[model samples]
Target: MLKFVLKRLLHMIPLLLGVSLLTFLLMSLAPGDYFTTLLQNPQISPDTVARLKAQFHLDQPWYVQYFYWFKSVLHGDFGYSMAYKIPATSLIFARLWNTFLLSFVAMIMAWAVAVPLGIWAAVKKDSWIDRACSLIAFVGLSVPDVLLSLLALWFAAATRWFPVGGAQSPYYDLLTPMQQFWDRVHYLILPALVLAASSLAGIMRQMRSNLLDTLRAEYVTAARARGLGEGWVIWKHALRNAINPLLTIFGYSLASLLSGAFIVENIMAWPGLGRLTMEAFFAKDSYLVVDSVVMATALLVMGNFIADLLLAWSDPRIRLK
Candidate 1:
């Protein structure tokens, strides 16, 4: 198991390098500068523009600038954001937690709901409940997250029950500690639902299909013939094998879920790394852009690692390999 983990970790290094290098190159090659918008003000003189450009090392050759970028990155200096007038690392860290919180919650909720529903659907086969769940899953898969968010916002408006968007209401800061917790969670409802909807669809459908296949396998039928309790036969034996296929994709889902967080954050004004990345990109704050990408990549790698560990724990075959 340790060897397998180590091997996977080894493989991740080059993947991260490729991601960073490609991101850096893409950002560099893009046609724009931090100064482009700033210099548009007729009141700002060329001297000021030149000074600003030089201060941020925009005057340096691309290669030289990137070399220094690599150096600073190694030393943990993620550089400054001209747009926000703050260090890139600090800004990113602030948003990172929010993004992480939302993504993790949404993914957990989706899996929790999906796995059971999937198992039930599989056990029932083409029955009405299965057909209805399939239809719901189909609609969820088809619907755009943006539209879902908008619809959720409308629902909140109509009901006046949940805060429409943002991480918290204006009264959040004024609330007592316990109320604050609940308020924030309330704010999370819409965004979390939006983020998890499609994921729930996919997970449910995948697990249902997987469980059905496992239930049909010879081992499962043999277990039933041996007078194994129905619950134990299905939940213990069939589920264990059925879940293996789901586990493989779960790692990829973690990374994709974070990527999806970007869009959801922007729509809901959740104040997360996704929104920060967008702001940095528009401002041509390459320092922030590069650092944020690297940080996101690191997070994604960590998520994948956790999934690998979970997979190993659940499957003895994986441990041996």
Candidate 2:
């Protein structure tokens, strides 16, 4: 297992290099840059733009510029964000925690709710509970995330059940620590629910299908024939095997949340990496854009790697090759 993990870690070096290089090339080839916006301003002289370009090594060959950027990356410097007038690291990291927090909570909420609901639906089969779960899942799959977020925002406005937008209440600063924590939680609930809704549906359906199939298997029949309680047979024997495939989805879901959160966060007004990435893209902040892409790709790769490890652990038949 250690050897397998080490091998996977080693492979990530080339994968990450390719990802970073591709992002760098794509950004370089893009028509406008961070300076392009400044160029459009009437007051900013061309000479000033030239000076800024030189200062940031933007005039250098793309390949040369990449190496310079790469060097800074090695030293934990993700280059300066001209648009925000800050280091890319600082800007990204500040927002990264919020993104991570939101994604993590949303993921937990999704799995916690979906898994049990799926099991119940499968166990109940054609019962009313199963039908209800199916209807909810259908709604989840059908509704686009942007629309869901907008609707959630509207609901919040109407019911005052949640903050309409943003990561905190206006009274957060004056609140006690516990109050502050709850305030953040209150703000988080809407966006997290919005983020989790679609994924929860997909996961629940997948779980239901897998569990149903597993329950019909010969092993499950054998377990039943051994006079085991239905609960024991399903939970102990069937569920373990049924959940193996879900590990793969669990891995990819980590990265998908980043992209999905971009839309949800924007609509919900949650300050997170998604919004920052979008802002950086439109501003053509090359360093910031590259950093964001690289970070996302890294998360994706890590998620897959973790999934592979979990799958192997869950199913001994899937030994690392």
Candidate 3:
């Protein structure tokens, strides 16, 4: 396992470098950069603009600029955010937790709800309960995230039941620890629900299908023939095998939630990496954009790596590979 993990980590280095290179090249193709608007300011002379470009290596060829940026990255420097006037790493770190919090909450909610409901649906196959779950999953899968976010905002507005947006109330610090926790939860509900709803459908459907298939397997029949209780046969034997695939899904879902959170965060004012990335892109903060992209890609790669590890652990057959 240690060898496998080390190999995956080693593989991540080249993957991140390639992603960063592609992002840098794409950003360069855009007409202007962070300093382009500065040139329009009559108060800022051409020399000042030129000097700024030189300072950031923006005046160099794309490959040369990438070389310097890559060199900085190797040394654990993610480069400066021209727009925020801070280290790109610091800016990303500040928002990274917020994004992680939202995604984590949503992921937990999704799995908790999805797994049981899916199992039940498969167990009760063709019953009204199963039909109801299917209907809910259909609606969840059918609705667009943006529309759901807008509806959630509208509901929050009309009922005053939830905060329409933001991660916390302005006076969050003034509250006691317990109060702060609930305050965060309260602020988290709308966006988290929005994010979770998007994922719950697919997971539930996959679970239902996997369980159904597992239930029909010859081993399940053999377990039943061995006089195992129906509950034990289904829950212990079938469920164990059925759930293995979802573990793989669990890994990818984190990165997907992070990516999906971008639109939701912007729409709902969640104040996360997605919003920061959007702001950076609009400002043409090259280094910041590159860093954000690299960060997200790393999450994706790591998520899959974790998934592979989980897959190997859950099913010993995979470890041999």
Best by lDDT: 3
| Best-performing candidate as measured by TM-score | 3
Clashing pairs in 1: none
Candidate no. 2 TM-score: 0.94
lDDT of 2 at 161: 81
After superposing all C-alphas onto the true structure, candidate 2 shows an RMSD in angstroms of 1.7
Which residue pairs clash in candidate 2?
A: none
Candidate 3, residues 1-321, lDDT tens digits: the string is 778778888999889889999998999999988988988999999999999999999999888989999899889898999988988988888787798888889988998999999999999999998999999999999998899999999999999999878889999989999999999999998999999999999999999999999999999999999999999999888999998999888887877788789989999999888998999999999999989888888877877887787788888788723
Q: Which stretches of candidate 2 lie over 4 Å from their true place?
A: 169-175
lDDT of 1 by residue, 1-321 (tens): 678778877978788667777777788788868897867899999899999988888888676777777778779788888888988778889888888899989998999999999999999999998998999899988998778877877888899988766887787778999999998899887788889886899999999999999999999999999999999999988999999888877888888788788888887788888888998898898888877887788888888788778878888877534
Q: Against the unseen true structure, what C-alpha lDDT does each candidate score?
A: 0.85, 0.89, 0.90
Candidate 1 overall lDDT versus native: 0.85
TM-score of each: 0.93, 0.94, 0.96
Q: For candidate 2, lDDT tens digit of each residue in 222-294?
A: 9999999999999999999999989989887887787889899888889888888888888888888888877
Error of 1 at 67 (Å): 1.5
When sorted by lDDT, best at the front, the candidate numbers are 3, 2, 1
**Alpha-carbon RMSD, candidate 1:** 1.9
Model 2 lowest lDDT segment of ten = 294-303
